[model samples]
Target: MRNSVLLLAMGMLLATGQPGLADDAELIKNTKADHEENGRWYTSDDIPTYKIAEDGTVDWPTFSGFRRYNAECFQCHGPDGAGGSYAPALATSVMNIDYYKFYETVVNGKQEVNAAQNLVMPALGENKNVMCYLDDIYSYLRARGTGDLGRGRPAKKEKKSEAFTENENACMGE
Candidate 1:
């Protein structure tokens, strides 16, 4: 009876097309899902890293992430996600927070207050500068958190994928 109820619940969740359920399943199964680009998904653990070339042209997304992070996030989060007097270091925070939580926090914002201090993160879900390149921001931050990328602008990067360009254009309505 319990098994049947669990199965029924799973079926209902699938029918509703909820997002986190799949991530939960992936976690339980110890499998990483493919990262999506242009609504299509592909598996790659190294896709987010900056690539170096002899001439030093950087990848678009990671470079864009640096630009966006400095423009929007650095004021509060500090340079290179190192945290500040006002905000906790995202390089450390992202280590424990799941991607869904990170996404939701950015979209919805968060606030915590106590005798020691008040911490507030403003909502940016509707901001085009953030909403359009959330994936890139995540990629860059993840790289920073994992020590895959270092401080300062990368010297070089791989070429942007066609899917990345398509998604960027679509997201920006260009």
Candidate 2:
């Protein structure tokens, strides 16, 4: 009876278009199903989610992350997110920053000047290459930051899902 009432309330909330409730419910369900870790949600089928193998190979998203990071981010952030002489170490920094902050920083960029140095991060929101694979990059960096994924190319990876392909096509406008 309580479950029925809760379901009805959720239905009504959905019908009313109240923001976040449906997503929250889905997040709750996914969390209950063990699709979340350390506050990061993992949608294995639709979005890029990673898994580590016994021999230390990561899933496709993490692999994609490695590629994307090296291509788009390495010059500024340094190899393996270790930070260049100019930029901060993302491998360590990402672990402390919230997802929204990271997103905002990447998309809008940041500039800070202290007594010692001035730092600038150029906005990449308009760059389709980065935007399209932002999640994957984040996943890889987060994994690295948490020490869950090691530096370098993974030897093996899980296959990409049809949903990922579909989403990628839509995002890329293909």
Candidate 3:
């Protein structure tokens, strides 16, 4: 009956080694950079994503993201968003949770406490460093989550755009 069909479908998916194939397709589509402004790339849905050159050059914002994440987030999320004893892998689920939720969570923070565990992420809404480069952080995590960018520092990166430099200065109150 229906359960048998469902089981068959699940088995087929596993056998083919394409777990969540449909989800993968959607992820690919949603993460494709449709445009760029000030050296940052965004998908058609307005979510951040990394852009890489054929010669292995990463976009500036993505590089900025790596720096920002390491500076602001790695303490809990572990190096390269790989997760740690203290936090889940942001790189693993950022894409799955989607951009809006990620933005909301980072800005407002989240807390869960119980006998088994207590988890909390402090709000970064007022942190100029994080808030200013939120998109870049998302772009970097998305790239890592999607396997588009590997761990460690990117060797080649495009020069930061003047607009990005100006915006960063303004946001940071420099």
Candidate 4:
């Protein structure tokens, strides 16, 4: 219920590209990167997000997110999350949906059937390719959703952290 409401509100805001109210920006604004753990940067809210440097260089995670997203998600979500006939535009969707809800939807999947229409998102919690890089994907979409990052590959990116590589290898069973 709450997720639906949040989605609807955010949808309207994204559609208009202007806040209907003064505080609407608050609802859509992505938080700043406050700290890092094991090579991943997170917001003060403790959720994964993106960070772009002054020189248009993106964080390693965001860059990785782009790679991972293109590797699979673009098939349904469309390149750069622009939304396809099969799936909605995730770039905007991520901004409106809270991080936890996004995780839940991606992991558990979502189903809504009605007289109006039918929508289904398959459960991907077990897809190691996606699950292992979930945070990176989220960060990439967050950057896209907030317009902090542009479409296509990033011109520059930070180097991958050792911690990230280890965790990724472990997750991938490599």
Best of the two (2, 3) by lDDT: 3
lDDT of each: 0.70, 0.73, 0.88, 0.87
lDDT tens digits by residue: candidate 1, 26-102: 54222122555543222354233333234755456767777788888999999998898899888777666766788
Candidate 2 segments exceeding 4 Å error: 1-33, 36-49, 113-116
What is the per-residue lDDT of model 3 for residues 49-154, given as tens digits with 9 covering 90 to 100? Answer: 8898888799999999999999999999999989989899999878678687889999999998899999999999999989999999998998898788999999
Per residue, candidate 2 scores C-alpha lDDT tens digits across 1-174 of 999999999898779866555654453222111264432337543333456767876766678788999999999899998899989998777656655677889999999979977988999999988998888887788777767777777677767666767777888889
Which ten-residue region of model 1 has the weakest summed lDDT?
40-49
Name the candidate that leads on TM-score.
3
What's the candidate order when arranged by decreasing TM-score? 3, 4, 2, 1
TM-score per prediction, in order, is 0.67, 0.71, 0.82, 0.80
Q: Predict model 2's lDDT versus the native.
A: 0.73
In Å, residue 19's CA in model 3 sits off its true spot by 23
Clashing residue pairs, candidate 1? 51-157
Model 2 earns a TM-score of: 0.71
Residue 114, candidate 3: Cα error in Å is 0.8
Candidate 3: worst 10 consecutive residues by lDDT? 19-28
